[model samples]
Each structure stands twice: as structure tokens, then as C-alpha cells.
Target: MISSPPKLREGLEVIRGMDDIPLIFDPVSGHYHRITRSAEALLGYLDGTRTRDDLVAYFSENARVDQARADAFSRQLDTFLAGLERSGLLEGSEQTEQGTGASPSAGGKRFRTSMLMPRVVLTRSLPTVLEPVARVLRALPARLIVVLATLGAVTGYAFGFHTLFTGTPGLRDLAGPAFLIATGVMLLIVLAHESAHALVAQYLKVPIRGLGVALLFYFMPVAYVDRTDAYRLRGRGGRVLLAMAGVLSDGWFCGVVGLVALNSSGLVQHTAAFLLGMQMFLLIVNLNPLMPSDGYTAVEAAAGLTNMRGRAFTLLRHTIRRQPLPEHLARFGTGARRWHVTYALASVAYGCFLAYAMFHTIPLSVDLALSVVGR
Candidate 1:
């Protein structure tokens, strides 16, 4: 047995969820790999150990894997080891067989760091001043936030939306310095929007990995904060708050700007109308539950289920095929299965809306861009 700790690639981020699912992020590949608890324990043994046989023997003897599955794993342990090596997580491998170590139950789920758009960090991860902000926020009652957010939402729907769309700004409003100032303000608002998520997450004691802008689809730049650790928070409400933070921030900002725009006159009114419309549009977009946006995360929290959409889709497939649910799918409780089924139906309708929105928005964005440049 060449029992030496295998070389682990650097710059990989390891995170553990409250469910103990291990998420390994490869910065170089911009991919996140989620491995099961058994896989995690096996990988833990790879600390500078170069031999696969020793780890296999150790796993066979002392691993906390399910007893029913132990004999099966023992039979195919070598293939599992090989799968780990093929993932490029380890620097070197003594085994050459490909797709090794990929147990059906323990296999990794790979996500390319995003869902709708490709993300490349405009700035690398760094420390944030959000800790102090979180501290201040934590000192306040959670009830206060909920009340304020509810009130703001009610107010926005009642009056803010009307002001946002009633007085339409012409393309001329977006032609010159007026548009530039609005863009700058919107950027600042976006930064604040992402920071709100970070702050709420910090208040919940979730580690903030970093915040940066990413060029969404290689065109428009979007700001985002790494609040992936929010999953580690045990309280479902905490996770929901973290997910809803940015949406609440947008709502509040839009309400404030809309009220101000309504009270003022002349160019201030026109420009503010334009800004408020854009922000309101963004707020609605972020709150779309069918997308992988804040609304989706909040729904997941409410349902106390991670990967709700995936499970929902799986349930749909099984129902269509008239087959027994897979063992992994059986892990979901009765209530969770019901929720997944409901979400699945809503998702199909929302997905169709999203498709139409994307197709229609592209031409509008091009025309808007040309109008700004052409003028």
C-alpha cells in the first residue's frame, strides 16, 4: 500500500452544510462539487497519503458509511478512488482507471458556479466591513425587519408601482448625462443590494467569502456576494432572511426613490421615474420564484429543502414513467414530496414566462443601447 497523503489542489474551498453535505469548490475550474458524507470521509484520508489501497482498507474498517451499503462499497472501492482522481482534485494518482470512486449514492454533483449566466469574478474574494453592519443589524429584532419589509412591500404595490410606470421617460431621457448619472446611481444601488444579502448573512453568523462584480453573459456586469455559507445556518428562517435580504433592499430603495420622485418636479421627476422603473423591474425579476434567484432560495428555505427544483423535476419524471422513486428521492418526507410536486407545476409556467422575457428583452436592450450611443 503506497499509504502517503495524496496532494490536494490548492485554492479549493470546502464548505459543509447543516445537512453535512460537503461542497468542494475548485476556483481554477469555477466549479462546485458536492460529495456525500462517505465521500467526504474518504477524501479526508487523502491528506498527503499517496496510496489508494490504504484509504480503501481504512474506509472498509472504520468509515461511518451505512451498514447495508458497506459490503457493496468494499467491492467497488477501487473504482470510487479512481473517480476522485479523475476529478482533478488530487495532484497525482497511483490508479489509472477512469471514472473511479463514483458510487451511485456517493457521486459528486457538479455545478458551474452559476445557473443562468456564467460568472467570472471581476475581483477576487476579500474581507468585508459587513461584520459591523451585521452586528448593528443583529442588535435589532428580526420582527422589526419583517414588519418593515412587509410595510414597504405593501406600500410599493399600492403606490410605488403606479409612479414607477405611469410617466414614461422617452429615449431622449436616456441619451446623455441624464442616463449616465442614473446608471451610476443604479450601480451604487446594486452594490448596496448585494451588500444587504451579505449583511443579513453575517448577522446569521454565515461566513462571507467575498463580493464582486461579474459580467453576466459577457455583456452586462452584475454584482454578487458569496453567501453560499448561508446553507450552514441551522435555522430555516435565517436562510430565508438571507435569501430575501437583497429583494427587501431593492424594495425599500425603490419605495424611497419613488416617494422622492413623486414629491419633486421637472428633470428630477423624469430621471427619477426612469431610475425607479428600472429598479422596480429588477426587484420583480429578483423575486421570481421559478428562477435561481432570491425568491427560489427563499422558497427552498421555507420548504426546508435544498435542491427543491431538482427534486421536483425528478418527482415529475418518476410520475410520468410510473416507476418507483429512487432511494435518494425517497429521502424526502411526505410533506416535502408534496411541496416538490407543487413547485414543479409552478416552475413550468414560470419557466415559460422567463423564456419569453429573455427573448423579448434582448432586442429591447439592443435598441436602448443604440439609442444611447446614436444620440
Candidate 2:
């Protein structure tokens, strides 16, 4: 479970979206909120000291929203706080004077400490030869053509997928070399994916923070583009575009590899087929909606779900613990009700799926090695 900083007050600390939504913060007993822009401006006055009336007056003077409007917004804000409280995102009894003092526990910052430099390596401007490739992606139709050509090459290797003991070296005998060469091609395709993402970020005028490789497990190095700057885009569309760029590239690469392998003949063609198939498998697996992979981001972008997954998970656990409900029990809806339910269910399901895969998906050889041998 994701725990909030203990020092920070319970309730919505910040409401993030295009429209100004209320991000409530209930200290202890009293619930406070900032719905309208005027109310948000008054947050500066909360130096852990101001009274409610003082805060209200400050809002009226500095950011003038009529008293009635402000009052209405405040009430809605209170309602939101109450919901959060019931949902266990807020603490303390109602009617209690929430303190304006420092919290008892000033929790330290939570950081994922790593010896490795946390940088993604695709953001550096592409090499001259790669620039044309990026430009061509801007035209997706032509891009599809290139992908088909690659797939054709991959498919061309299939010599009828038969295993024969003839004088001629057959497809099965060549599987080893085929896998290695195919892996190399797939790696290039992976690079293409990273390049697309970086290029898109550059095109959008977003600065590439850095690029670096991540050690997947131990030996595998996954390329990454650090485009956190793209998150600052005002609209959901831009964010979605940046996120999808990689997946789009992967999909295109898969298509191209498949086409090439299926259309060719002989050992090289067979190798291409195997390699293309492997790439497609990787694409599908990586795009599994459960994990924080390309597919996960794509789903988040398409659904316009910003923190909806987090909130849903929070709510689902709360309901499970408090309601004593069975797995099949129907859940009640709240704000963004449908999306909340979907997001929560998906999050939980995906979480469980990932846990299962991590523990149980080891290779047979690894399991054999771990077993104690009794002679």
C-alpha cells in the first residue's frame, strides 16, 4: 500500500487536472479546502498559524470571490474532506479544532536511493542518420510502410518450418544462431522505440533531462528516455502523445520484422521469422496493461486517468477492511464512479498477477539449481 507522509495533513493535498478541482486538507478535526483559484491563493496564508476567518478574509481581500461563492465552495470542500475521512484518507474526529502547528512526526523525505545514476539515455539528440527516421515517424502512414518492409524481411526466412535430416541444414538446426541474430535485430528495434520517444519530446520543445541504461535484473540493459519535462504539458493529449510514441514504434517494428521473416526463404529467412516472432511476443508482453510498462502508460493516457488508479486502490482496500465484504460484493460509486471502479479493479488484479509472475515464473534450470541434492 502507498502510504502518505505522516507529517502531511490528511485529505487531498492537491487536485491536479485541467479544471481547478478541490484538493482538501484536513489537519485533525477541522477540514480545510482549496477549490476555486481564489481559495488556492489563500493557501499561502496558512503558515501553520492562521484562523479560518483570517484565511477567509485574506482570500476575500487578495483574491476576491464573492462571500457567497466562497462560502459555497468551502462547503463543498468540507464535503470532500468528509468523504476522504470516511475513506480513511483523513484522520481525527469532526468538530475538533485542527492544529496549525508542526506535526508530531516530521517524516523524512522518501527517496529511492540508488548507487546508479538515475538517468534515461534516449534524450540526447539523435545521431544525424537517426534524425531522418524521426522525421519520417511524423508521417505515420509512410512509417507503416517501413514497418511492413521490415516484417517482410523477417518472414522471408521461413523455409516451410520443417525439421528435416537432409544434407541441407534445416530450420531446426539453425535455431541457435537464428535466436542470436534475431535478438540483435530486436535490440535495434528496441532502440528505434526509445528514439521515437526522445524525438517526440524534442519535437515538442521539451528538454531531454538525460538518457541512461537500466540494468534489468543484472545483465540486460534497457534504454530509457528521461522526458519528465513532458508531464508539464497542459493538456492530456500532449502527455498521451509522448507516452504512446514508444509503443507505436514497437508495434511498427514488430510489423516490419514479421513481414520480412514470413516472406523470405532459407536459413536467414528462418532466423528472421523466429526473431520477428520473438519481438512480437515481447511487444505483447510488455504492453500487458498490469505493469508500469508502455501499455500501462498508454492506457492511462487514453483514459485521462491521472491518479485515478491510486485513488481507486486506496478506496478498494478501505472498503474491503471496513465493510467485511466478500470478493463478489458490489462496490458503491463515488466521484468519477465508473472510472474509479475500473481503475481499482485493474490495479488490484494487475498487482496480484505481477506478484504471481515474479515468484513462479523462474526457469526450470534455476529451480533445479536451487534444490538441495541428497546423495
Candidate 3:
């Protein structure tokens, strides 16, 4: 056995999560590890002063186990420490020495792109630059302003809906320039939507590392802001807010565009109306709970569950196969099991519905694209 005790790396922050779960955040790698209470206590003992034998003795005394059990525990402890070292949680791990892990900016801030989801970084210091705006948004006056804007947006939507469905312009009138202009404006709205998430993260003291644009799922072009530091937030409320901020911004923009369409005429009205429709469509898409959208993120945060979709699907698969629950899931309480099963059923049903909708909507979308380009 090694003579030296393992030392946890510096700059690691341990925070208590929901249900008093211990969450360790590594700032260098931007990774969070959820550990059990026993593991957390073990981490405290790894202060570099105590040797491996000392830790084994400590565990033996505290757990009140015999020599055989203590020996087994020492082997388990070695395995655990090895895993931690590989994860860069240890002071002298290969990852720490090589400066490698999930952190893309460890070398330098450059464009990190992938064919699956290509993205370009627009800024890396958004928190410092947007500090003034974040401050204003967190103030009481900003809340009042938001309230007023919401009211106006609702009024605009009401009138705009009536005008649009009744005796307003047709799609042909919105063809060519109007449609192109509205599409450009909608892209800007997407930027604003992502900015809202970053702003809220900054307000909650989460670091905003990078802000830019990306093709989500390699097809849907969208703005993206790096709010990965949100895992450090201890409160569910902050996490939910950070997730829903973009959706709220989308709704607000939809309302504003509706209001503009309601009061305008000719080309301007046509553009606004088209923009409103686009925003509303995207808002619905983002609110889909079956997908990894803002709505899904909010639900996961509120439930205090990580990777809910994956877990739910796994549980569903096991149930369908009539297999026993996996070891990890078998440890879940009755409430958690119920939640996983229920969410799995709902997600499957919603996914089927979406597939059906897409089958019918594809032709319509193609025609719409053709019409917009005046084909």
C-alpha cells in the first residue's frame, strides 16, 4: 500500500445539495460529482497527513468492523481513491498534471467546434461585461419594467391575433423581402433568449464562460450561452430560473412582436406577424418536456434529478423487458421509483405524438420554405 494519504485537489468546492447530498465541483474541469455521505466523510480524512494504513484504521474504528472487513474496506478504499484520481479530484493525478478533461479553455480560448453541434465563441468574459445589465435586471425597477412590458405584450397579442386571423395580409404578401427580414429578426430574438439565461446565471453568481451560436442537433441553428457553472447552485429555485429564463424571454419577444404587428400595416405589419408566428413556434418547441429543452431542464431542476430523461428511459426499458431494477435504481425510495416510471410513460407518449405531428408537418414546411423564397 502507498504510504501517503491521497490529497484532494485545490480549488474544489463542496456544497450540500438537495436532501443534504454532497456535491463536489472541480473548477478546473467544470465537473460536478455527487457523492454519498460516507464518501464525503472519507474525503475529509484524505488530508495528506494520514497514511493509507491510518485511514484503514480510522475506518475500522468508526465502522466497528473486524480485521477481515477492515481489510476488504482498505481494498475498496484504494479503488475509490484510484477513481477519484482519474477524475482529477486528487492533487497529483494524470489529468491534473496534463491539464486535460472537459475544460476546453484549459489551453486557450479558441473556437471549439464539432460536426454534431458546431459552435463559435463570441465572448468569454460575458459576466464582467454584462455586470451592469445584470445588476439593473436584478433591481426592483427592472421588475416593475418587466411587469409593464408583460402587460403590453399580452394586450398586443390579443389585438394582433384578431387582426391576423380576421382580415389581415396573406402569406403571399409576406413572401420575399418581408419573410427574409422577419427571419433575420427572429435570429436576433434567439440571441436575446440565450442572453437571458446568461444574465440570470450571472445574477445568481454563476460564472458565464462562453456565449455564442451553435447548430443544435446539427440542424437547428440557435444561440447558446455556457451556463455550465449552474451545477454549483445549491437551490432548486435558482436552477429552475436559469433554465426557464430563455423560455420567458422568448414569450416576451413574441408578445412584443405581436404588439408591433397589431399597430402596423403593409410590409411592417406583415414582417411582424411572420416574426410573431416564428417566435410562437419556437416557444412551443422549447417548452417541449419530452426533449432536452428549457422545459425539460426546468422539470429536472424542480425534481432535483440529473439526467432524468436517460434514467426514465432506462427504467422504461427494464420494465418493458420484465427485468429487475438495476442495482443503482433498486436503492431508490418508493417515491423516486414512482416518479421515474410516471415520467417514462409520459415521455414515450409525447414522443409518439411528436413523431406523428412531424410526419404531417414536413410537407407543409417544405412548401412554406418554397413560398418564402418565392419559388
Every candidate's lDDT = 0.64, 0.49, 0.71
Cα displacement (angstroms), candidate 1, residue 80, comes to 4.4
Q: Could you say which candidate leads in lDDT?
A: 3
Candidate no. 2 TM-score: 0.53
Give the poorly placed runs of model 3, Cα more than 4 Å off: 1-4, 17-21, 49-53, 66-79, 96-118, 141-173, 310-375
Off by over 4 Å in 1: 1-16, 20-71, 76-83, 88-116, 124-126, 165-180, 217-220, 304-375
Q: By TM-score, is 1 or 3 better?
A: 3
lDDT string for model 1 (239-300, tens) is: 88888888877777777777867787666676677678678778776887766678888887
Q: Measured by TM-score, how close is model 3 to the native structure?
A: 0.76
Q: What's model 3's overall lDDT? A: 0.71
Give per-residue lDDT, candidate 3, residue 295: 85
Model 1 TM: 0.64
Write down the worst ten-residue block by lDDT for model 3.
97-106
User: Could you tally the backbone clashes for each prediction?
Assistant: 15, 31, 0
Clashing pairs in 3: none
Error of 3 at 100 (Å): 17
For candidate 3, lDDT tens digit of each residue in 40-152? 87888888888888888887998899989998998878766776776778877765422112224422345554423477777787788778887876775645655664565
